[model samples]
Target: MDSSVSSLTQYGSFRKPTFPLSNSCRHKPRRWPLALRFIKGAIHHVILVPILLHTLFTCIIVYIHINIQTLSVPANIVPSLSIVVGLMLVFRNSSSYDRYWGGRTNLQSIGTSVRNLTRSFLVCGPDRDEADRKETEKVVKVLVGMLYAVKNHLRSTWGHGYLLPEYKGLLPEGMYGFESEGVGLVLELAVVVERYIKRGVDRGAFNAPQSSMLSSQLNALVDAYGKMETIKLTPIPIAHQIHQKQVLALYCCVLPFCLVDELGWLCVPIICLICFMLYGIEGIGEEIEDPFGSDKNDIKIDAIIEDLRQEVSVLLDSWRRGGEEYTI
Candidate 1:
């Protein structure tokens, strides 16, 4: 028991530290009270029309079965049909969650690459003269601008007018015409950064090997951009989504007939409860599948970008201090 305790203590020490940039951590899934949750939850909003309609249908079925006709379905059919519907929901929810998690992973990769490249640019590159210092500062600003441009591009918010004021001036004069050229603004900014790097090489600020390393970091940034684009653009097939909804609707519709015989009027509320659960599951999949939208459940990219901005500011400060002489 002592050995086990010691191992657990060691494991606890190595656990990952939480940061505000992670939307899942910063904006934890809320647990409103049952009444409030019905009003506030995204799932409820989506399934409200269906639930109301189904509840009405359930009442009608129940009334007809008791007053006019003896309506019922074999109890065994419920279990058998449920198995198939459950599998379909599981598959859909699983696939959507995978896309969500993959998007988060790519976001972290982008942050990591930005930090590394900025550090290398500031520390390893030359800053021997005022001109050299200004060049380094320009490149650093462009690096950050590229990050913001990527975020805007993913959101489909184009135009240089959308960029922050400080970063706006740093962009090339003709950059406003990026859309006309059929090139992504983020890619165009990358091209600008590369040109600055090439100029640095020509001026002997970076040795060939150092330049190569920096270029690899730039590649990582673009690779992450490509991956996130794939996530944003390539949604789960519409045909599969339509099919799943059809099956779920069928399940909810048939569930009442199966229960009305055994439970009678009590099955009305029971049907609502079951519809809420099943439709809620499918609704959650829709909410999280994209992970990049402005929805509360989507990634908090604005927060993440703000955090990155803070980090870049600190790095800039460090670069300035290192250039100054200190008295002991």
Candidate 2:
């Protein structure tokens, strides 16, 4: 029937292992107008508004040119003004890109954490648990659960403060977590797993070397989580952002006037196009600055979190059932 109703499902059962499902599923992106996507979201710089200003000035200049009592002004001065505006636009666009890239680099760190954690969990597990091995098997599945939790936490895709429908009921209820708190929880989970390993070693269920290696791996995962949190929360200073936006707006408004003297009536449409392009680009950069937002261009955090939840559900369920039986 419907996947969303009960909030959990396996891709299969019995003879085959199934892919887990999650309730935090996301829908496809909503399409925005081409102009709005580029101008409003891509170029938060509002670059086009300045161009509108320029267009206004150009319109004024055109009116003046057509009715001028004399063509006495030097032609070379107008060209110089055009050059200056162009240089300013170039600088503004370049700076916007720098901000966007900085955010992207931060998100990439999550991939590193995922790889390191996954390998460590798989490698450090006790292999000799065939006797009363059910508990050990369950813990192994917890690693899968942990992976999904970490992914959902980073994405901010949660329901009632839990990772999602599949994971929510399993975690401690009533506790809400932001990025910083989520990292703390992840570290705590590592500690829980470490304790289990120590217990296993003391009882001759696991080896000493494996326990130590697992500890180091978990620690590395914790470190990566911290770094990601730092990037997600920290942003460029407010004053700089404000100044950049204001300067871009003012520049666009005066662009049309500068062009009017050179292109005559043609400056109207040309200036409008220029303004739209610059503004759109700047808007895109602004949205990208915080790729975690709900904006159209923002990263699909909900979807990522949902996938994590689903994958984790598979791991946890398979573990609880005793991994030996999970043939897939």
Instruction: Tell me the TM-score of each prediction against the true structure.
Output: 0.85, 0.62
Candidate 1 segments exceeding 4 Å error: 1-41, 162-174, 321-328
Q: Model 2 residue 71 lDDT?
A: 25
- Each model's lDDT comes to 0.79, 0.54
lDDT tens digits by residue: candidate 2, 112-188: 44444444444444546564354444444444445555555556654433335554444433445444643455655
The top-ranked prediction according to TM-score is: 1
Give candidate 2's TM-score: 0.62
lDDT of 1 at 77: 87
Specify the highest-lDDT model's number.
Answer: 1
Tens digit of per-residue lDDT, candidate 1, span 66-159: 9999899887888988998999899989999998888888888888887887887787666778887777777787777777777777888766
Minimal lDDT window, size 10, model 1: 319-328
